[model samples]
Target chain A: MLQYVLKRLGIAILVAVTVSMITFSMIYLSGDPAIALAGETATQEDIQNIRRVYGYDQPIVVQYANWLWNALQGDFGQSHYLKKPVADVIFERLPTTMLLGACALIFALVLSIPLGVVAAVRPNSLIDRIALTIAVVGQAMPSFWFALTMMLWLGIYWRLLPISGTASWANFVMPSIALGYYITPAVMRLTRAGMLEVLSSDYIRTARAKGLRPMTVLFKHALRNAIIPVVSLAAVQFGFMLGGSIVIETIFAVNGLGFLAWESIQRADLPMMQAIVLVLSFFYIILTFLADMLNAWLDPRIRVM
Target chain B: MAERVLEVEDLCVEIPIPSGMLRPVQHVSFHVGQGETLAIVGESGCGKSLTSLAIMDLLPSKAKRRAERLVLDGDALTGMTERQMADIRGNQMSMIFQEPMTSLNPAYTIGNQLTEAMLRHKSVSLAEAKDRAVWLLEKVGITAARSRLGQYPHQLSGGLRQRVMIAMALMCGPDMIIADEPTTALDVTIQAQILHLLAELQDEFHMGMILITHDLGVVARVADRVAVMYAGQFVETGTAAQIFDSPTHPYTQGLLECIPIPGKTERGAHLGSIPGIVPSLVGEIRGCHFAGRCPYVHEACTAEDVSLRPSLDAGHEYRCVLSPQAAIANRNKQAAQ
Candidate 1:
C-alpha cells in the first residue's frame, strides 16, 4: 500500500509540473502582455519601459522560470485587475466555489444512484423510462440555458427557490441543481449499466438465493460492487464540477472562482487567470489520482496487480 | 421415505426473442423429498440450470416462469409474492451455483455473507450469527475458521470458495438446496472433495437437494433419483439405478452411451457419441422435440408430440413412443439379424 501511495504521488508531481507549464504558456504566449498591461494608447517607448518593469522584456523561457519559481512559494504575481495578490484573490473566492461544487456533487449522487439502481432492477418499467428520459433531457439542454429557465420558472413564477446570487441555501438551489443535473446523466447511465451488470452476476444470484430482501440484495450485494467503477467516474466528474461550475455560477450570480475567472478573462488579468487555471488543473489531477486509489482499495483484484 | 420437501409440477420458462418466444424449459416436473438427492442431469443449454432457477423463482427478467403447483414444505409457491418468497428463500431453501469464485461477492468478508442470510430470515443477534458462521466454516472443513471469516472471497482458493459456498447455503438451515453444477469449475480432485462434503452435510441436515450436472459419473455417484433433460424437456426420470441400468428413452440411451465405461471400451476406439445438435426451440412444434437427433427416426415419432409415459414400476417414467421393454427387444432383434 505504501508503495502504491508513493507511486501515485510521483505521478501527481509529474502531472502538476505538466499542467503548470501548459497553463503558464497558454496565457503568456498568446497576446501582447505589455500592451494589455500598459493599455492600447501607450507609446512604443512607454510600452517598452512597462515591459522592462514587468519583466515582459525578458526571454519567454526566463520569464516562465521566474514565474514558476515565485508560484512555488504562493506568489503568483499580483492581480493588477483585482488590485490584490493573485493567491489571496483566488483563496478569497475558493470557499464559495468549493461549497457549490460539493453541494452539486452530493445532489448528483443522491439522485443518480437510486434512479440508476431502480432503472436497472426493473428495466423498461415506467420508473426506468422516466429516469432515462430525465437523464437524456438533462444532458441535452445547454447548462446556461437550463439555469436561466429554471431560475425563471422556480424563482420567478413558482417563487420556490431564490433565482440568483449566493445569499443562502435557497440562493444555492438553482445553480447547484443546474450543475448537478449536468453530470447526473453520466452518473445515472453508468450506475444503471453497472447495476444491471452486477445484478446479473453469479454472486447476486447467490445473494438472491439467500432469501435476502430485494432491497438488501440490491443495495448490499449489488450496489457495493457496482459502485466501484462509478466512484472513479464520480471523482472525475467532481473535478470537472470544481472548474466547470464556471458557466452555471456566472448565469446564477453565485459569486465563486468561476465568476472571478470570467472577470479576469474579460479584463485580460494574466496573473490571476494563470493562477486559476493552474490551481484548478492541479486540483483536477489530484482528484483523478485519489479516485484511482479509491478504486484500487475497493477492488483487491486491481490492488494486487 | 422422508417427508416431501419440494414439489414442482409442469414448470415452464419462456423468453421472447426477436425471432419468437424461446422455450428454454417446458413442462418440467419433479419432486424432492427430505434426505433425498434428485440430480437433474443434461448437457449445457438443456434447461437444467433454468429449471433450478425456475424453482427458486430467480429467472432473469426477460424470461417468464410458470408452474402448475410449486410447493415447498406443504405451502404453495406458484404465485407467491416476492416479499413472501423472500421469507421462504434462504430460510427454507437456498441455492449453490457453478463457479464458486463468481458466486460469492468480492467486496464482502466471508463472515458478512454467511451471517446475512440467518440475520435476514431470523432475529438472531450478530454474535450468534458470527458463531454460526464459524461453525459452518469449520463444518465445510476450513481451518482457522474464526480468522477465515475476515477474509474476502478473492483470498480463498477455488476449492475453499466452493466449500464456503456450500457452508453459506447451510447457514439458515434450509430444508432444500439447489446446487447447480457446484463442482464443475473446480479441479477434479477438489471436485471430489466438495462432493463428499456436500453429501455429508446434506445427509446430516436431511435437506432435499437438487444437483444439476452434465457428468454421468457425478450422477451415478451422488444421486438417489435422476431426471434426464433434453432441450427444455425431461425425456427420462427414475431411480438412479433404473435410469443407469435400464434406460428407456432414445435420447437418454444416447447420453448414457456417450459415457465411456473403463476397460469395456476398446483401447484407442472412439467412445459412443450422439450425432446432430439440439433442435431450435423457436415457433410451434408439431412432433417429438428430439426427432431430428434420435438414431431411431420413425415417421410416427415426428408425427405427434410425446408425453411422459410410466413403466410398470411406480415413478419410473419416460417420454418416448416405444416402451422400455419393447425398445430393448427391438435392439435384441436387430442384433440377431
Candidate 2:
C-alpha cells in the first residue's frame, strides 16, 4: 500500500509538471508582453522600461524559469487587473467556487443515483421515462445558458433568488443548480447503465431468493455493486466540476478564481492569468489523483494493480 | 407417506415476442412432499428453471402467469405482490441457482450475505445474525466459519461459493428449496460433494427440495420423483426408478440412451440421438410437440395434441400416445437384441 501511494504521488507530480509547463508556455506565446503591459499610448522608452521592470526583457526560457521558481515560493506576482497580489486575489475567491462545486456534486448524486436506480429497476415505466427525459434535457442545456435561464426565472421573474453575486449560502442556490443540471445527466446515465448491468447479475437474483425486500436487494446488494463504476465516474465528474466552474461562475458573477481568470484575460494580465491557469490546472490534477485513490479504495480489484 | 409441502398446478408462463407470442411454460404441474426430493429434468430451455421461478413468484413482471393454484404449506402464492413474495421466498421456499461464482454478490462478505435472509425475515440483532451466519457456514462444511464469514465471494473458490449459497439458502430454515442445476457449474468432485451435502441437509431439516437438472446421474442420486420436460410441457414423470428403468415416453428413452457410460462402445456406433431440437413456442402446435423427434412417430402422433396419462403404475405417468405395455415391450425387445 505504501508503494502504491508513492507510485501514485510520483505520477501526480509528473502530471502537475506537464500542466504547469503548458500553462506557462501558452501565456508566453502571445509575444512582446512589454508592449501590452505599457499600453497603446506609451512611448518606446516607456515600453522598454516596463519590460525591464517586469523582467519581460529576459529570454523566454529565463522568464518561465524565474516564474516557476517564484511560484514554488508561493509568489504569484501582482495582479495587473486587481492591482493586488495574485495569490491574495485567488485565495479570497477559492472558497466560493469550492462551495459551488461541492454543492453541485452533492445535488447531482443525491438526485441522479436514485432516479437512475428506479429507472433501471423498472425500465419503460413512467418513472423510467421521466428519468430519461430529465437526462436528455440536462445534457442538452449548456451551463451558462442554464445559469442565465435560472437567473431569469428565479432572480428576475420571481425575485426568489439573487440574479448575480455570491453573498451568502442562499446565493449559491442558482449557480449550484446550473452546475448540477449540467452534470446530472452524466451521473444519471452512468448510474442507469451500471444499475441495469448489476441488476441482471446472478447475485441480485440470489439476493432476491434470500427473501430480501426489493429495496434491500436494490439498495444494499445491487446498488453497492452497481456503485463501483459510478464511483469512478463520479470522481472524474467531481474533478471536472472543480475545474469547469468558469462558465457557470462567470454567468452568476460569483467572486471566484474562474471569474477572476476571465477578468484577467480581458485585461491581458499575464502574471495573474498564468497564476490562475496554473492553480486551476494544479487543482484538476490533484482532484483526479484523489479520485483515482478513492476508486481504488472502493474496488479491491482495482487496488490489485 | 410424507406430507405434501408444495403443490403447483396448471402454471403457464407466456412471454411476449416481437413476431408472436411464446409460452415458455404451459400448464406444468408438480409437487414435493415433505423431505422429498423431486427432480425436474430437462435440457436447456425446457421450462425447468421457469417452473422453479414461478413457484417462488420470482418470474420477471413481463412473464404472464395463469396458475390455478400455487400453494406452499397451504399458503397461496399466486397473484401476491412482490413485497408479499419477498416475505415468503427465503423464509418458506428459498432457492439456489446455477453458477455459484455469479450467484453470490462479490461486494459483500459471506457472513453478510448469509445473514441477510435471517435479518430480513426474523427480528434478529446484528450479533444474532452474525452468529447464525457463522453457524450456517460451519453447517455447510466451511472451516473457520467465523473467520471465513468476513471473506468476499471472489476470495472463495467455486465449490466454496456454492457451499456459501447453500448455507445462505438454509440459513432461514426454509420449508422448501428450489435448486436450479445447483451442481451443474462445479467440477465432478465438488458436484458430488454438493449433492451429498444437499441430501444430508434435506434429511436434517426435513425440507422438500426440487432439484432441476439435465443430468440423469443427478436424478438417480437424489430424486425420489422425476418430471421429464420437453417444449414447455412434461413429457414423462415418475419415481426415479421408473423413469430410469422403464421410461415410458420416447423423449425420455432417447435422453437416457444418449448418456455415455464407462466401457460404452465407440461414438457413432448406432449410439442414440434425438434427431431434432425442441420446437420453438412461437406458434401453435396441433399434435405432440415431441412427435418430430420421436422414433415411434405415427400419423396419429402428429394429428392430435397429447396430454399426460398414467402408465402401468399409479404414480408413474407420461405424456405420449403409446401404451405403457407396448413401450415396455418395445424397450425390452431392443435391449434383448
Candidate 3:
C-alpha cells in the first residue's frame, strides 16, 4: 500500500508539471500581454519597459522555468491590473467556490441515491418513470441555462429568492441547485445500473432465501456491492464540479477562483492567470488522488493488488 | 410414522409472458414427514427450483401463485404477507442454495454471514451469536472455526463454502431445510463429503429436508422418499427403494436409466437419453405432457390426460396411462432380452 501510494504520487507530479506547462504556454498563445496591459496609447519604450519588468523579454523557457520555480515556493509574482500579489487574489476567492462545490456534491448524493434505488427496485413503475424523466431533463439542460431559468422563475417571477451576489448562505441556494441538478443525473443513472446488477446476483437471492426482509436485502446486501462502482464515478464528478464551477460562479456574481480567472483573462494578467490555472489543476489532481485512495479503502479487492 | 411437518397441496405457479400465460408448476403436491428427507429430482427447467422457491415464499414478485393449501407444521403459508413469511423463514424453515461460491456474500466475513440469521430471528446477544456461529461451523467440520470466522467467502474452497452455507442454514435449528442442489457446484470428492455432511446433520438434528437435484445417485444415497418431476409436475413419488426397484412412469424410468455406472457395458445398451425437450409452458395440452417423449407412445397416450394413481404397493404412486402390471412386465422383458 505504501508503494502504491508512492507510485501514485510520482504520477501526480508528472501530471501537475504537464498541466502547468500547458496552462503557462497557452496564456501566451494570443496577442502580446504587454500591449494589452500598458494600453494602446503607450509608447514603444513604455511597452518594452513593462515587458522587461515582468521578465517577458527573457527566453520563453527561462521565463517558464523561473515562473514554475517561484510557483513551487508560493510566490506567484504580482498581478498586473490589481498590483497585488497573485497568491493574495487567489486566496481571497477560494472559500466561496469550495463551499458551493461541496454543497452541490452533497445535494447530488443525498437526492440521487434514494431515487436511483427506488427506480431500480420498481422498474417501469410510476416512481421509476418519474426518476427516468428527471434524469433525462437533468442531463439535457445545461447548468448556465438552468441557472438563468431558476433566476427567472424563482427570483424574478415569484420573488422568492435572491437573484445574485454570494453574500450569505442564501446566495448559494440557486447556484448550488443549478450545479447539483446537472450532476445528479449521472449519479442516478450509475447507481441505478449498479443496483440493478447487484439485485440480480446470486448472493442477493440467497439473502432473500435466508429470510432477510426486502429492505434489508436491498440496503444491506445489495447497496454495499452496488456502491463500489459509484465511488469512482463520484470522484470524477467531484473533480468536474471543482473545475466546472466557473459558469455558475459567474452567473451568481460569486468572487471565486473561476471569477478571478475570468477577470485575469480580460486584463491579460499573466502571473494571475498562470496562478489560477496552476492552482485549479493542482486541485483537480489532488482530488483525483484522494478519490483513488478512498476507493481503495472502501473495497479491499482493489487494495489487495 | 412421524407427524407431517409440511404439506403442499395443488400448488400452481403461473408466470405471464408475451406469448401467453405460462404455468411453470402445475398442481405440484407433496409432504415432508418429521425428520424425513424428501428429494425432488428433475432436469433443468422442470420446476424443481420453482417449487422450493414457492414454498419459501421467495418467488419473484411477478409470479402469481394459486394453491389449495400450503401448511408448515399445521400453519398456513399460502397467502401470508412478505413480513410474516420472513418471520418464518430462517427460524422455522431455512434453505441452502446450489452454488456455494455465490451463496455466501463476498463482502461479509464468514462469522457475520453465519450469525445473521441467528441475530435476525432469535433474541441473542452478539457474543452469544458469535459463539453459536463458531460452534455450528465446527459442527459442519470446518477446522479452527473460531479463526475461520474472520475469513471471507473467497478465502474458503468450494467444499468449505458449502459447509458454511449448511452451518448458516442450521444456525437457528430450523425444523425443515430446503437444500437446492447443495453439492452440484463441487468436485466429485467434495460432493461426497458435502452429501455425507448433510445426511449426518439431518440425522443429528432430526430435521426434515427437501433436497432438489437432478442426480439420481444423490437421491439414492441421501433421500428417504423420492419425487420425480417432468414438465413442471410430479410423475412419480415413493420410497427411494421402491422407485429404484420399480419405476412406473416412463419419465422416471428414463431418468433412472440415464445414470452411468463405471466399467459396465451391455450389448444394445444405448446410453439412455430422454427423447424430446420439455414442452413450452404457454399453451394448454389436451393430452399427456410427456406423450411426445414417451417411447411407448400408444395412441390412447396422446388422446387422454393422466393424473397420479396409486401403485400395487400401498405407499408408492405414479402418473402413467399404463397399469403397473404392464409396466413391470415391460421392464422384465427388456431386462431379459
lDDT of each model, Cα atoms only? 0.88, 0.86, 0.87
Candidate 3 stretches greater than 4 Å from native: A1-14, A17-68, B266-269
Q: Superposing every Cα of model 1 onto the true structure, what RMSD results?
A: 2.8
Candidate 3 residue lDDT tens string, A190-277: 9999899899888998888778878889988999888877877877777777767889989989778788878877877778888887
Which ranges in model 1 have alpha carbons more than 4 Å from their true place? A31-52, A55-66, A158-162, A293-297, A300-305, B16-21, B312-315, B330-337
Task: Write one digit per residue (lDDT tens) for candidate 3, span B1-337.
Answer: 8888899999999899888988989999999988899999999999999999999988888888888999998999977988999989988999999989887878778888888878889999989999999998999999999999888888899899999999999988989999999989999988988999999999999888999998899999999999999888899999999999998888888887787766675655677788779999776876778888987778888787789899989789998888999887777776566
Chain B structural similarity as TM-score, candidate 1: 0.97
- The per-prediction i-RMS, to one decimal, reads 1.2, 1.3, 1.3
A109 Cα displacement, candidate 3 (Å): 1.5
TM-score rank order: 3, 2, 1
Candidate 2 CAPRI category? medium
Best model per lDDT = 1
DockQ agreement of candidate 1 with the native complex: 0.67
DockQ of model 2 vs. true complex: 0.68
User: Residues B223-305, candidate 2, lDDT per residue (tens digit)?
Assistant: 99999999999989999999998998988988888887657655656666788888889868878999878778899888888
- Reference-based lDDT, residue B138, model 1: 94
